[model samples]
Target: MSEPDPGLSSGAVVAEPETLHAPPPRLSSPLARLALDFCASRPAVAGLAVILVVAVAAIFAPLIVPQNPYDLAQLDIMDGTLPPGSPSYAFGTYWLGTDVQGRDMLSAIVYGLRISLLVGSVSVAFALVIGSAVGLVAAFFGGGLDSLLMRIVDIQLSFPAILVALILLAIFGNGVDKVIIALVIVQWAYYARAVRGSALVERRKEYIDAAVCLGLGTRRVLFGHLLPNCLPPLIVIATVQVAHAVALEATLSFLGVGVPITEPSLGLLIANGFEYMMSGRYWISFFPGVALVVVIVAINLVGDRLRDLLNPRLQR
Candidate 1:
């Protein structure tokens, strides 16, 4: 053994070897953390990419697609039902072909996606607002009012969402606004139940008691104090519900009780092509069906990943 340095004090202690550990990467904000979490999963990233592509196509359909599927003046009846890759006299190459009305399949699919997303998003927003309000009021009060509200939710929940939507549509007649209203009525019950559950737990927390003790109004106590804490699960539900609303709207449209003929959706496009499937005109329905599946699957992937990311138990 080597002798210790003579200059060192008897009570002095030598330092241990330093371990070479890298510092954690800095996350600038909550959004940055969410972005990192989202990118950590390859499937979620791919789903997001697909959603972005479809959304972009839908948003810029008129600029990108060669023909305007919705414009009567742009269509030529002679070109109707052209097969994929067929040559069009008016628009050069019809890459995805034309429908029965001589509308380009690609353009129609993009426009249909636009309509589906629009209805889905708007209905979800309306449902969230209506449901959250009902849930907050019920949970915050916790009395006969809660019992009455909950019984209504229970009755609505007993029926299938599609069945309820169909019944409402039957009574209201078919149109975009009517379809949205039907979807909201069908979906609000779900959000109401979810929000009420979350609010029930949150209402007992210290912050909620403090807010109440501060003489905050009922609106402030429910909306401001309780609602924010209950939002994580609501966000996850909203993402999944939007996909549900889209599929439900498509089903209603396919059954001839959804959007009007003037405003076509993927469901309507598929329905239009159903009669010709026995012939060789498969591309009409096939392409639209694929688009619908892709949109639904992509949204589901994102929603599932969000559920995992947001849930603490799942994180463990």
Candidate 2:
């Protein structure tokens, strides 16, 4: 047969063997590769660095702070209204100066950060749990449940979040727990909307279909399968939402409808300092404002980086 095909092809032409090309190396895991890509990017790296520093500061505030802002015994009435460059105060010591209550501005900022971060984190966690549950149920069940849930979300969205928070605060009275409740109530809808959209898409994927075919319970399919896939967006949203929650808490405190007067938030500090600003005690509010800016800015930067890292289209 080979001899016969020398002049003309018997069945098919016998062409020279084509050069074999080595296949591209496979990534160990998509997530691992994505993480590497983010770390390598400048903005992502910088954002991560800033967030790390802030986190470190927050975690070690008790040890790192020069004074305990919360301990009234450590305070001095004469230290109140000290200017920024007072010789006794020192540079980083009174880096921000003292508040009207003679609390070290730097220490106040550190302690304030603890409160703000706590409120923000707890509120975000609460929102995530509630939102994810609502979204999963609404999307998985669909029909009237979806319509009803989404309608409520829409109605809540119609009002400003701060207004809703204010109303809740008024009803609940001022306290840390009340502030958290207000934040959770106002912020959960955002997560619900995001999760619902993602769940709608995920519920129709091949894996979900396969799971359904295998007789997996709806709760398992929704929680075990769909939830994991919906996390990337949720993580980014949660990061940004924490900043918002912190700001909202500050706003509520400033409005005198937030944390107790004994435990002043950054907002309360700002509000209190407003009176002293003309009296030359500028550090009280200024330091807290700066602290707030740093925390929020750092969080936002990290959130933006996370969004880029998680979104395939945004990956470089």
Candidate 3:
């Protein structure tokens, strides 16, 4: 009794070694890892490489372009329709040829890409924020508001995106900002629909219930707990929508209601060359058209990759 039982002694009792689970091997960021994974697929890597090259070229347009295509003063009507690699061109030789205005085809493509990227990026961003907000609110607070919003979304969806843009442009007049606004109006519904669907699921989760029970405000619950979970889908949607938006912008500009003649977008360039396309002056429209296709295809490739990576259901 004075010595104490051996089993009860602290020295006699052996403790189990603490097992530290190695933090689940750090997975690279969704985008970074996905980009790395793209190398596994030739097509994905090709698409990614195309985007990077185009981006770099677009960014360095000022340095690389022989002259600003937009500067009307520098253009020569004689240079117009000069075939690609034509020695007859005023600059001695031209790659991708020139439009009716003799603006460098390569330069125009670069400049047009920049504008397309800008308008597409901005419009999608605007739409994302507004749509996410509307969707979250509708999901968080249903009834009349939900009905009204969802019905509006349905109505908008009934019409084509192009039709919506055309109508809005007609009412507002043509310009980059106007096109962006129209796109946001037309596209917001899709985002809203997506976000609302996500929010509906998230709102029903036990965490949301716990948050509500803890006296968390609607703002905190809606944004803090719910929004982050909803982003992967939204991000993938946004990436694809960028291609859609760029195409739309090009369409608007081609229709003479976008960016204006002075600031030619890819659509406008294509339109400008359309007249000469059959006349053997194909490069004018052909190159820009190819650029647009490439941009859209590349973006879709990346978007598809992102969807596969982020979506558990899609993982093979």
Give the best candidate by lDDT.
Answer: 1
**Lowest-sum lDDT 10-residue window in model 3:** 15-24
| CA-lDDT, candidates in order | 0.91, 0.84, 0.87
Instruction: Indicate the residue-level lDDT of 173 in model 2.
Output: 99
Per-residue lDDT tens digits of candidate 3, residues 1-316? 3776678776676655656644556556876676667577777777778888888887888998787889878788887777888764345568787778778888889999988988988999999999999999999899999999999889989999999899899999978889899989988988999999999999899998999999999999989999998998998999999999999999889889888887858999899889876788888888999999999999899888877777878775
lDDT order of candidates, best first?
A: 1, 3, 2
Give the per-residue lDDT digits (tens) of candidate 1, residues 221-280.
887779998998999999999999999999999999999888969999999999989999
Cα lDDT, model 2, residue 209: 91
TM-score of each: 0.92, 0.87, 0.87
Query: Largest TM-score belongs to which candidate?
Result: 1
Candidate 3 lDDT (Cα, whole model)? 0.87
Backbone clash total for model 2 is 0
lDDT pick, better of 1 and 2: 1
lDDT of 2 by residue, 139-227 (tens): 98899999999999999889999999999999999899999999999999999999999999998889999999999998899899999
lDDT score of residue 182 within candidate 1: 97
Pairs in steric clash, model 3 = none
Superposed Cα deviation of residue 286, candidate 3 (Å)? 0.8
